[model samples]
Target: MDHDWMYKASYTSEIYAAGVQSFLSAAEANRVKKRSRSICCPCSVCQTFQYFEDITEIEAHLFENGFMPRYDCWSRHGESLAAFSTSSTANDTTYNDDASSLNSTYNNDSSNLDENDNHLNGPDDNLNEMLHDMETNMGDAEIENLQHLFEDAEKPLYTGSRLNKLDAVLNLSNLKSKNKWSDKSFTKLLVFLHDRMLLEDNELPISTYRAKKLMCPMGLEVERIHACPNNCILYRKRYENEHKCVVCGASRYKQKKDSDEVDDDEGPKQPGNNIDVYLSPLIDDLKTLWDLGVNLYDAYGKEHFQLHATIFCTINDFPAYDNLSGYTTKGKKACPVCENETSATRDVFSTIIFDIMVHLISHIVQEIKACGPVFLRYMYPFERYMSVLEGYVRNRHRPEGGIIEGYTSEEVIEFWQGYVKGLDSVGIPKTRHSGRLDGHARVGFKTFSPSHEDLHDAHFVVLKHMTCLAPYANEHMQMLRLTHPGKDDM
Candidate 1:
């Protein structure tokens, strides 16, 4: 609020702008001859300094790490600074008192001081009160009278305590904790770990690696990978002693399930430390995604391009669109384009399409390993998992568009030609289909001769509008007797 701080902010902002223009010019020159000058940095501040290397790096760090909105961000930072300045501000308490006494008609102490002031100050909740008190009373300006209360309301039952109470609550004496041997839940666990060989540090944190060799169409980056890529997702055999293990995917959580707990008639009990296991939700997530992948293939191969959004429509209570089947074309209720329920449904799939893939794969490994006895087939371990995946596709991962390729125009054409056509029409060699493009069916959008750039834009449009499905992915995987993220460190 002071002129000094205001002047500094303006100077900093201008510096940010000047830096971005430099980066943009450089990036534009680097683009392919036919490609658009679309040098996307995603970080708005970085976008501003598209040309300056040093300033752009600074902007990138700020955006990637503490990328909060301006006012909230500024207010939070100010609150932190005020916290550190408490003693100094107290030194100003006398100054405030002297200033207030000058206006003897005003009683400031009676204004800002209140019962809740004894407790923690609510962030947004105190804004209106602070303004009212500042206008009415003079005591609010006193540093001693205006002590800051750090509220950690974001954490449930978090009352400014460093020690976690949940751990104690979980460690009670007489609780008939789950016996992992239940036919419902086997002691099996899934261990999925992927550590890219790249070293990382605070400077270049979460070293991103492209899985170029991973047979995936849409390449992904490993944020914190170390040499080993674990789980079914990494697509390599687990190197440890996988045989004598119950195969639980827990890494560092103390899961309950004694080896001897299972009955003699049921099966042989595997042995281990049993508590600390390693599993990421991404594994089982892949299994569920594979099912959707199968369905997509089935639908598209047979020219069943009715579209995933069409299949999702059969689910009751889902939102529908005007001109869409089951909804009247005229007099139908609709909001703005983004607010439309149809887009919401599509987005549920589009955004989560890949996350679903990750979660499905993660779940599949955990389900078979953790719930070994209950698991029947080697392929489709849990029957409910298929329905879970379908429900997720319909209810959760729904995207405005049904694909998750993060596509560009060129990529879109390649998808249609290499994937859509190869699977449904022309043949691709030596892969899941084995020496020829696997499966059969008429596919629309194949050989449809669209410009390369248009295809990319369409794919990006689909991805940009995509949404993720976390509820179901977290649900089934946890239900399968595997440890959840909050339950473990890894």
Candidate 2:
């Protein structure tokens, strides 16, 4: 009963071993009462979700990985509240009797139950709940694909094979990606396996395209929402069927194409101030989350609960802040907090520039007071992410599509990486100097002697960029020009 050994003692310690032994005995008793061979393993790795029939395997897992943190209750292993309290005997008896009756009824009518209902009592309760939640959002084709994937997951790659159909396909896809295999090469390999190796009857895909299609259900679904050609608004909700832009009055489709698809090359490069229109979907989702909340499974708790959230504050650069906050970030009255009280200064030309950015600096303290901290609301992370998105844009003419495709591929690769362990990573592999300090290379080093000209050039470059030497360098240059009139300054 003293669960302190879980955290205080090492897995190999006598206290921990005794604790695991006691836990297994109780769990085994519970398993026998439920007429089940397997009991949920409460080890950190298994987390009470994965079931194990062999008691020795469960014990080994606990010894190797230790029990899941904060599992003192043992609720899943049949240690109920009634066992701790004698006062609840009458209420516990009544509840148990009703539960037994319900269980008997369900068992008697098992044949009439739906496929989803059958999984309700199975170990894959999380998967069933997730699929049920996705049903409302996914199309018929996506749902069918997901169901097929689920079915394939249970079937082994071959007789007595440890890997399932899903695992085999995922592992193969990961290998192809990591090795940078060409489509033709992958197809040939698949052909060799299926034809020559005699694995054609198994669930192995014969082509790279087929394999990708099979793995489609595992990737996140992308919704292609249409937006106004003029970047005024998205053609959704109220403008779901509108032919022309409500604000700009421009036709949604290209005149030459005579179709609903707008030419990507012809549209505005960026949404500019109309970004709010593009963020309508995100805003709606946030509003729903704040109001009604969403049902999400808590892995640690082993139950579903309503998750509610709201944006604390927006983090963006000045230009983006102007568009999202609907405040002018330039000219006079640019400071939203100061507004009319913004201070102005005249330049050397006696012109009042009214630089909003300079004036806004004075009110940074007030902004920080309202928004918690400057670092919390800074655009450093967003700017770094923008660089990553820029790298994804292979096709400059259709940067949006390029980024979406690249990002989706990365997401799928990442998903596969989670399932197919021990494979080489999918993206650009990290260099040896990844976590090293700037200018420090971890690779084998070589000494180099710079020539006189090279050394001079390097010193000149370093001195030219040094802020402390700037005034002196400028003064020396002025002296040189004054001392040698009509001569080249260099």
Candidate 3:
């Protein structure tokens, strides 16, 4: 948790002293009237600070230990504090000189205090300074816009029985996947049906825009670039504002149909023929999933934490050491997995974005497996998550946005249903086969309804090939029991 290394080496001691001084000041200002010699320190140095005889001892403890985690102490940020050299101070300078310098810069209303002596500043002055900094950095319009955005984000998506109807329509894959009508008309129709099902209907039916807006949380919105129509090159970076393709000398944007009859008042509009969606957001989310797994483990123990690094490693097909370390194959081998041989071939025309992060996940699998199988992560269990994204069911135009909108809308509806009508309203029934059977016999056991009976055959056939489990037979079990007498059943 000691993050002093993250900042510049010169600023480390300054940040530490500033934090301690601020915390001591705040502690003194907020002290109780009752007689108590000791006060708790909550700085990063001591998250749950030990009792101190007075402010002097507390300040000394903080200077040595450095600040606590930012969450524990407001003084941890010290965004406006100017750096001062306190490295030369003796162990017993009390850090008073450096502390006073920090107080003069960060603490307002210092006119009341003597110049030579160090005095504790109130938390109110620090809060005002922070407020002034925030106002100076952010404009009125920006603050208002942020406030409105957060308000909209907090608003409920749907209410009542309409929520249930929306859920029903969302789960219908046939309707979601196939397009019999325009998205606008389709959304209107779904909303109309939902309205009819509700006891208290909406005065106006849910519009396509609202329905689409509702989906934003579920889907990831990717930043798309207009690429060359002939698949020559992407109009990004150096080519971002270019009007023509560098590779083929073709127009980068789609020309207006009425180009000859141009309006004098308005400028010509340039639209790209082909758009390439950026994958950074999706990659970032995947990386966040790794963070989430670790957090889950820390919060609720291993039973609630599950991440398969192996399958993710295998499917991703990246180097193990490259991600774990900062090693790369630039001007050397193609991959770290392949040794850096002198005669390694290089592809000059390669367009794929190959970086340590693109294959960083493989290292997780390798590292986990090195410890033992119990900690080895697999990617197979996450395959269903791919289908979950596909299930959003939106049009090709801004596909990522549509997917996000559709998924979030469905999630909001499901959440409302669970809240109003109990969790079972949105929960699927668990499927389990009845009766005891040997492993081979269990493979044939049908769990599907009459409508899906044919699917059961196909499912079982696929499962047998996909899985590595050995088949069992009654005769084999009996023979094994006889051969190894009094052996426990597997």
Candidate 4:
């Protein structure tokens, strides 16, 4: 919670500028000033000597790209400084006294700290001092204060202690895909590990409920609802207060307990047979994403197209002409545009001309005639997204809630991993020569093109090697011919 040492140990702009300015010889410095030209900066940041007007400009540029005295301190304390300011700024003033006082003691008691392997001078010595100050500044800071720093642009920032443990717990959830662990088993393992961590640290392990309350970053909770065992009806909507199924007349709950566990007989005496989860929170979050413009991907990457905002028409095999009056599919009175319609049910289908499909198809034909086939719309891509959602229901007690958890957990992992977003895991072939291309070489050896009338067995031998016509090949061909005696090719 307190990061006073971060500021103290960090190199000032002047120090880094001085370090770079002093790196040059007096003669070189004098030449640089006389020429009034840019020189290569010797600092770690801009080593290429990017253009600067004079020595003063070069010095200012070098100072802007300041050198860090301790890489470990900059890496560790940068996040702590940002976190200390943002997360708990109000109560931070109280910890300043303790931090300052402990820092003073550390300045005096340097030798005493050496007994614990904490040297006052090393690569990590600055970090050690800062950590000590943070500890003394807020006695419970190590356990209670969680770092919530803004993400770094170039590289991911990692924090120590409780944040790392929480990250590990989160990462363990991702092992579900490969190991296929049951929800109860996974949660039990996590809680067991959490308890072990507490015990090993000489801290009193708290209950699972308390640990979750303290450690869960998102603080998401499951919503539980009681429902019928048969899933015939949810105990919601008009049946919200119902005690029994309206259609089945089944009892909504089991018999009451006989002991003091039964608090009263005022309500239903038993628990419902099923627990249904309502994931309105997840739905609300998806909606929030939509409102925030994050759902722009839903437009199927055609957002730049002018027609994207409009739903022109739905594409389907709708027999629109068959619905016309006096049209009989087999009597030549069928649809002029469709050549495959038959006599069956043409008149019956005509009665449904007022249906939504016919109206949409009419508009689609008009759009196609005016523009081209590109204007047509279909539900195929949207159905693919439905399949993705369906695949998320594994290893869960509740399929509906399980999907939400799996999807959100994957998103979190992907965020931390900094993966290129948006469903990049589809149709990755085993090899470049896999799929239809694998048989291309064999297909090139075919002696002749196969006909629809040719039997599968005859085509198989032709596909293997078309050029050879030896005794063995002839005998194999003869055997195939004898197996299919009635074939036209035979």
The best candidate in terms of TM-score: 2
TM-score for each predicted model, relative to the true structure: 0.15, 0.51, 0.30, 0.33
User: Clashing residue pairs, candidate 2?
Assistant: none
- Tens digits of per-residue lDDT for model 1, 374-455: 2253434344444533321221333311122222211323332332111221112235544235345444425467799999
In angstroms, the error of model 4 at 223 is 9.4
Looking at model 4, the pairs that clash are 40-49
Q: By lDDT, who's the top model here?
A: 2
Tens digits of per-residue lDDT, candidate 2, 1-490, equal 3356677788776667666666766666665444444567878887766776566788889988988765654656656432323332232211112334433433333243332321212463343233333333343345445555545554556554445666677778777766656667989998888778745457678898787777766455678888877788888888889999989898888677667886567744677887887888999999999999998756436556899999976667878767887777776566667667554432322345446566656668887878677766788777877887767675677788867865776567675564444545676576866646576665675679999999999999998999999899999999999999899965
**Cα deviation of 370, candidate 2, in Å:** 11
Error of 4 at 325 (Å): 29
lDDT order, best first, reads 2, 3, 4, 1
lDDT of each: 0.29, 0.65, 0.43, 0.41
lDDT of 4 by residue, 1-490 (tens): 3323323323463433233333332313332222222233333454332433234554555456543222211222223433444454442322212333433432343233223231111222122233322323332233224232111111111221222333333345445433546566766765676565544542222343333333333434455555654555666667879998776777799767678674454432222222112333344555665455332221222122211233245443333233323234334334344435333335445754433344345356666767677423455565666776667786444567767765665554444332221222222224655545555565446557767667787777776676565767778888888998877553
Candidate 3, 1-490: lDDT as tens digits: 1233213223346554554555555454433211223345544454432544355655655555544432321322221111111222322323333557544533442333234331122121222222222323343334433332222222222332222222333333224333323466777676766577544533223665544443322233345767665666677767789999888888987667755775564432222222112343445557766565332222212123455332144332233234334455344454555445422323322336544344434456666657555223444445556676655545554456666655555554454332222323322433464335434456556664655877798887877676353354456687899999989778
- Output candidate 1 Cα RMSD: 30.1
Residue 332 miss distance in model 1 (angstroms): 63
Total residue pair clashes for candidate 3: 17
On TM-score, the stronger of 2 and 4 is: 2
